[model samples]
Target chain A: MNLAFRDIRHNLGRFVLTCFGLSLLLGVVLSMIGIYRGLVEDALTLARSPQADIWVVESDSRGPFAESSRIPGDTREAIARLYGVSAAGAITYQSVETKYGAKKLRLYVVGYELDRLGGPDKIVAGRSIVRSHYEMVADRRSDLSLGDRVPLGRNMFTVVGLTENRVASSGDPVVYLSLRDSQELQFELAPPAARREMARDEGVPGINTVNTVIARVSPNVEPDLVAKAARQWKHLAAMTQMEQEIILTRSVVERARKQIGLFTAILLTVSTVIIALIIYTMTMDKLREIATLKLIGAPDHTIIGLIIQQALAMGTIGFAFGALFISSVKDYFPRRVILQPDDGLALAVAVLLVCILASALGVRLALKVDPGEALKG
Target chain B: MSLNGSHTLVEARGISKYFGEGDARVDALREVSLKVYPGQVVGLLGPSGSGKTTLLNVFGCIVEPNTGWMSLDGEVVYDEGWLRSDLRRLRLEKIGFIFQFHNLLPFLNCVDNVAIVLSLAGFSTTQAKQRSVELLEYLEVEHRKDAFPAQLSGGEAQRVAIARALANRPRIILADEPTAALDSARAGIVMDLLRKVAIDQNAAILAVTHDEKIYDRFDRIFHLRDGYLDIEQERGVTEMTQD
Candidate 1:
């Protein structure tokens, strides 16, 4: 064992170079897994923040991304009156492309009742929205800071606060505004179309409606009862917090989840094959030495152990490099690459296993080598 | 003659080894028998294709013969079947081998390479290392202990190989053309070291070589031809016939 370690130390340059190559591949695998985890985390962050017990939307729809769900603006008022409903608020959601400097940025605009119940839980910078309209709390990733003005539709809103990681299902950074703003952004028609519709409808202004009503239930009251009462109403669907998150994840981001899963699987397969080939080649290169060891009474187990130890060393070094490399450069990527501790740990274990399995090919070759070959001409 | 009650370190009876089968079969050794007693140097001399290596392999317990009764260190080790399943342990504990080419692991320093056999035999790392250093000092290569095998000269490497072979303190040392790669001077030095190790350690040494120039140094010489062995007494020694 001492000899084996000393041998590796003597050839440290080649060993480290091989480890670096392995680490790059391992880093890609780790990044893929992290990206998938990031997507899931980003989807749930907004939903979890509201602290709402139940969500009310249109019948037979998954919100707030997969399908349209518009409820009467007065639905919150009605739900507030219901038994066991402690608080209810109208919320609207929409994705829009807007200009920031010379670049176009995609934003998930979340409309909430500023004072009622829905808003960013904590502001990291500046102050929370003080005005009712044309003010927003932007997630830090949106590149918006306090006092910065961003154009939305025909109006421009000043960013009042900066939050972190508040992204929508599609992983776009979120911007929070009063419910009226989000509703207008989603439902407000063009001025010409609005005039044409009003002219056709005898010039009466339309009432406001919203995509969904989120409610908090009292601890003493059963949540299912409130949800049942809301579902009894026409054009309404009520779900508990758990159900809403599931609906969004299973319906809105189902395709992305599957795509990420497929990518992870393919990357893992490629990594395994590449590691196996590298170990096999290394073993083949040392065939003569291995034969001599065998001839000199070195046991098969010793030979196998040498190969396995080398494989494990390669994997450990590669994983360390990959982890460091990805985290150091993750911020520069367009999409969020979340490198978490658990993800790193899992990848380390996986890479180690891959290396062990990979070196089996080398072990087989070493085992089949005839000791007699050492004596041959 | 039976070596049942003698000081023989290795004894073989009617050893036969064949390769392949049917018409393609080649008999590498046929009905070969030899005895090597402790504290003596025995040389097996033969030309190419004369079964010298085949006999060495059988004596080294690396290849099982088709028919043989072999004993090592006064204990039966083979009788048409291997008596020990752990050939590696047998090789490490009972016999030492020095090859023509100094097959030291390239990545290891001279001392570590010498200590490898002891380490494989379950010695502590520190103990094996210390023993290797002691042996190198004995062989007069201690100054080059930290040098890798590649950095050592031919004579130093060969001397290191002898030290490695003696690491386990085996009762028998087998040298298969150990000096084949060296010049006359280096070969003489290696042979002298082998003889000193045999006498100082009280171990039997069996060396097979084509070099006849060093024959007088061996205590006994066996001439092998077509897998048959003939004992040749030295000119000054009296030949003892079977009673």
Candidate 2:
């Protein structure tokens, strides 16, 4: 055993080179897994941080993404009158392509009541929005620093604060604005269209409404009861936080999840096949030496150990490189690539298992070698 | 021809080995029996395609004979059947083999290559290394202990192989054409070292060779023709000519 390690160390260059190649493969696999996890995390961060218990949206619609839900803005006031409702806030959501410098950025613009219920949970670099309109708190991923003016619609808004990883279900970075500003963005028509439509409606513009009303129940109250009570209203359907998340996952992002899952499976299979081939090649290179060792009375287990140790070493080296490579370049990716310690640890263990399994080819070859071959001239 | 004081270290009784079966069957060794004793250096002389190597393989416990009983140190190791499944371990502990080419692992230095067998036999690394250094010094290659096999000359490499074979202090040393690759002078030097190690360590040695010059130096010579052993006794131990 000691001799085996020493032999590898003595040939450090070859071993390290082999390990480096394995590492690159491992790194790509790790990055893919991280990206998949990051997508799910980024989708739910905005929803989770607010700590709302229930969401009221249009019936038969996936909230904020799959379809539009416009309810009377006064729904918050009505929901707050319910027995278990402690607080309620109306929110508006829309995705828009806006310009920042030379780039056209796609942002999920969220309109919320700043004083009562909605905003970034924490500001990473700047202050939260203080005004009712034209002030924005951008997710850091949007690359907007404080005081940077972004053109949205026909108006320009100054970025007041920067938050981290707050993205919508589509992985678009979020920009938070006052409820009134977002409502106008969501429902306001062009001036010419609005004027013509109002002329037909006797000079009265359409009533103001919101996509959904998010509600928080009292600490002692059951969120399910509050959601059921809100659902009694015919024009609205209320969903608890859990139900809303499920709907978002199953309805809005299900396709993306499946795609990421398929990618993960393909990468795993590729990794396994590559490792197996590498081990098999290395074993073949040492076939004569293995037979010689057997003839000289080195046990079969020794030969097996040598091959297994080499495989494990390759896996360890590959994983280290992969983790470092992915983490160093994660930010450059279009979507968030979250590299967590637990994820890396799991990948390391998984790759190790793959290596062990991959080395079966080598082990079988070594075991089948004929000691008599060593005596042949 | 029987040297009484040098009790038998290896005994092969009516050993026969065949390959394939039916029409394709080939008899590699046919009813060959030989004995090598302690304090003796026996050489097996044969041409190519002869059964010298086949007989050596049987004696080394590397190949099972079709029919025979074989003993090492008066213990039956084969009796028309295998007595042990761990043949590799048996070879490691009881038999030492030296080939024509010095088959040292290239990745390891001379000391490490020599020490590997001891290490495999469960000796501590320090003990194995210490024993290896001692053997290298005995073989006069201690100065090149740190050099890899590739860094050594052909003669130095062969010496290192000899040192490695003696590392485990086995009961038998089997040298398969150990000097076939060397010149006359280098071959004489290697043969002298083999004889010295066998006498000093009190271990039996069987060397297979086609070289005719060193035949008189061996204590006994066994010639294999077609598949049978023909024993010849040399007059006495004589110092090898240094040239």
Candidate 3:
């Protein structure tokens, strides 16, 4: 008769409701994991987008993402002249908050030289920046349209192009500008600060510094070798493309990863505890029936089968619902949420194992039931 | 009636059962002995705490007797301790039990309640179900075979319970206060059904009850008091039968 299925059928409403409740808890857990993955991906988006073979920054600085690094913009010329260096581009990065309509928009501003390697690869709409001073390429997430003028510091820049999925480690949309404009916007002092410096007889700081100088090696040359050569310069530090990504993941987004992992572990534990409590309660509700079953000479496995099967059913159904829920709504989340099939499969296996461990309590209680209880009035 | 040639289905010799220990010790049964033959419906009558239920449990192999041997269908199953390692299997194959309440599994319909016993004894599902339907029809509750226990009337539930007990075609049936919850008319009907089942299946039936109204339905009645079967009642009954 498949007593476990029969019992669930008999109480279909309550059983479904229980599975639904469990699914909601599981859904939150899944979304948290996806969010963590998104954070890491977002953190590496700009780093990967540049596609440079080597990165040269100021000595002793992890930048241009994890920490601040400032080297003269002309460092690109020296790097471009180096052996095995095919091309080099000086770039500056700074976070800017400005008014977009009535809402505040945060953007990671990138300044690169014209005809350089550090630029948006995929322009989904409009055209790439044509003019050097005021034209910009903005990510679609910035909600800026072509020809929309956005004021930054002392100048208003027009959005000439649009990109997608381009964001900084902090989840801020990215915007691209000419190196001259970015350096002036990021390093140049405001008019008031410049005036104060002039009154104090100190010369205005040069607006010719950049955060990083990215270089691409020749086809036959090793990028690590080029980076090794660049590292010998006392005033410059260099890393291969792989090392930059490692630093961004390990240093920039490490805490967020650990936090999400802790949350996932705690949620799974809570799920185990909740499932155990629910299975225990369900077993308690059927003690008399179990005693009756035992009195009828039912094998111990039959009773144990009933409890464990119910727990497994709950876990399977709950995980299915949670996976469907998270998959359907991931795009609508504020940050990009990536749900990989491998992650879902891993969680499904986890849920199944957790259910088995959870049902132990119920099985123990069922085994302890006295068959003689059926004889009592 | 004197047993002359009929096969004994259930027999217990000098069974004793106790509970607790030392100053807190109490004897629930003392040197109880009896025999039941096929086609006989015997009744054990006693007041509350008189150990009639305890004796029934001992006969059913649910409880171990402190000192005694018990046999079922000519096999010596208990000698102070159980002779079989799998008491559950022995009970499943040899004994059937009915309780004070119907004790029908609430989740299972009437036919399934009856069929589960046969299933546990390794009958194929189809075979178990076929036997269940036949038993339910025999008990005249086949009309409610699809109804869950909660959906059936009290008498209907008890009939289903009886169908379950008879599913395995066991040689001996042990019932504890089987009619205690029924109205007088319904109790009489249940008792009549039990008697009919015993005669039809040629199974020995032992019922523990306090209800005096169904005493006429029993072929022989034993009185228990303070953990002992009253020997005078047996003698008086024998003398009355001779007269």
* Candidate 3 residue runs with Cα over 4 Å from true position: B231-243
Query: TM-score for every candidate vs. truth?
Result: 0.92, 0.94, 0.96
In model 3, pairs of residues that clash are none
lDDT of 2 by residue, A156-222 (tens): 8999999988998788999999888887787778888888988898574554788888888989999
Write the residue-wise lDDT of candidate 2 on B149-223 in tens digits. 889999999999999899899889998888888998999999999989988988888888888877866787776
Residue-by-residue lDDT tens digits, candidate 1, A138-207: 9999888888999998899999899988888787899998888877777788889888988898673454
Candidate 1 docking band: acceptable
Model 3: residue B113 alpha-carbon error in angstroms: 1.1
TM-score attained by model 1: 0.92
Q: In terms of DockQ, which candidate is stronger, 1 or 2?
A: 2
Q: Any residue pairs clashing in model 1, and if so which?
A: A23-A318
- Per-residue CA lDDT of model 3 for A310-339, tens digit only, reads 999999999999889888998888888888
RMSD of each: 2.8, 3.4, 2.3
Ranking by lDDT: 3, 1, 2
lDDT on C-alpha atoms for all candidate structures: 0.84, 0.83, 0.89
